[model samples]
Target: MNEYLTSLDRPIEAVRYAGLTVKLLSTGDGTEVIHHTLQEGSRWSMQPQEGWTASESIFITSGSLKVTVDEETKVLSTGDVVSASPIKQGLVFLALEETEFIYISSQPVFQFFSEIVRKNQELAIEVALKDGYTAEHCKRIMQMSMLIGERMELSPGDMCTLNYASYLHDVGKIMIPKSILLKEGPLSEEEWEEMKRHCTYGKELLEATDSPYMRASGTIVEQHHERFDGKGYPNGLQRDEISPLAYIVSVVDAFDAMTTDRPYRKAMSVENAIEELNENAGTMFHPEVVKIFIDLIPEWSKMKQGV
Candidate 1:
């Protein structure tokens, strides 16, 4: 008996791994067809999987890319084709433009993406932690952001964007000077201005990947610092000018930061965190998101205490 599934049963889900956006177009039958997109200047470095024998051919659909194998670089333009499988040693690709391609493999593949995304997220967290943010700050923000998104009934795409944006909202801190990022006291006016540049830096970093999820995430990251009352940084985007996902993240991010230890101060009590969030809801965050998160606080505290 032959088994087949409809598109509804096997929907196409895009996966952003490292710098490449991948979609499994077809699978099984001992073969795999993947659609990929890489933005200009993005680099993808893949090491060979042990004992892997998946031989795949890459066909460029549009734009251009430079493939380097064993230190020899070759540029592939639109309509170009190349056979490179099992990801040979020292194989790397740099997108010269917004490149798209199709990869047909003689063997079914995947699974490696989980590890790749995990490691990348860990690296991002490590980079953020180096600046004195709590280890679990981003993780908490991401969890609450997802829950708030669900409560607000966000669309599937918006939920995905929220996940990435909330987790990486502070990733631009990597660009801030250690002196400013790690200061024990409040930032001076000039230093505060410099600190605000992180929003722009984060957007640039993630937007360069060109993946749909990351690009949307970049927009959210850029606006996550924006206040609802037009008092935010980088831009004074107010009210509806802000991305809804960013508003969700802003509430969650502020709550997490308030409730977590920092280089300059100790963590606030749960009661104080709640009060702070409520106090600034209209000015610093979206009223609805803040309300949703505030409602979730007691439930979250119970979970934390294993009650």
Candidate 2:
């Protein structure tokens, strides 16, 4: 890796192989380091000295794992490291819950990881379209949120998370009943409660895949509905408790929704939407992000018009 760019700058992408989530970190000298996410039901196994010859090692970062090495079984938790070794019985690794670890290998699988990320993205977009979001809407939100991200000077990893979170934010709508989603009037309290489940649903859907950006974005998706003052839903996380990416997405999400036509009402003028954003600053939305977004409204409008 270049001294100028850390591994986080290596493009936020990850791949799922045989149900295991893997993020290819860096590669050189035929050796590579990758991050792995092992869900509870998922297990990883290596055949006894199977063909590929590079030695492998694992360092568990979080969650618990059951490992069977050379007929010996042990349960390992966070901060545990399994050194590189070859055993005749091969290896069996099962996650007791959603687990994260770093794996180093003397082999390269970049091309393979890259391809799975691509396919996962393609499928995510398709899933979004099926749930009633127009392609243009998703694009505008992504562009606007990224603009806010840029203004905030978020790190490369954070900016990527913001972009993807905005794109997939509404995916949870898929689980809502079409009657409720397409209703021409405001939702009743009961319906509103059900509708809000989209945030939780969105997180679940995104977490099911290996795409690094998508999985990372899931946190923002679930928190975008939350308010800075602690009145948001799914979970009442407030103040700095929310992800900054979620805050940026929340502000941009509101701006776009207000200024665009919806089944429930006609679009609010840009001035009104701007006013709404200002009115809620420091309470409903983060004041800083709202200011940054409002400051860039003209530029945002140009992007919206272009879209």
Note the clash tally of each candidate: 0, 0
lDDT (tens digit, per residue) of candidate 1 on 1-307:
1235566466666776434688777777778787888866554433344455667688889998876555466898989987766545534456889899987877654433333354445545554543434435555666677677768966545666676687778777777887886666578999999889999998987766624446567889999889999999889999999998999888877776677665557879989988988899899888888889888887667544535
Error of 2 at 10 (Å): 31
With candidate 2 superimposed using the best TM-score fit, by how many Å does residue 176's alpha carbon deviate from the native?
Answer: 1.5
Question: What overall lDDT, based on C-alpha atoms, would model 2 receive against the true structure?
Answer: 0.72
Regions of model 2 farther than 4 Å from truth: 1-133
lDDT of 1 at 111: 35
Candidate 1 deviation (Cα RMSD): 15.8
Give the per-residue lDDT digits (tens) of candidate 2, residues 60-107: 999989865544679999999886554244345668998899888776
CA lDDT of every candidate: 0.71, 0.72
Clashing pairs in 1: none
Clashing pairs in 2: none
lDDT of 2 at 258: 79
TM-scores of all candidate predictions against the true structure: 0.59, 0.58
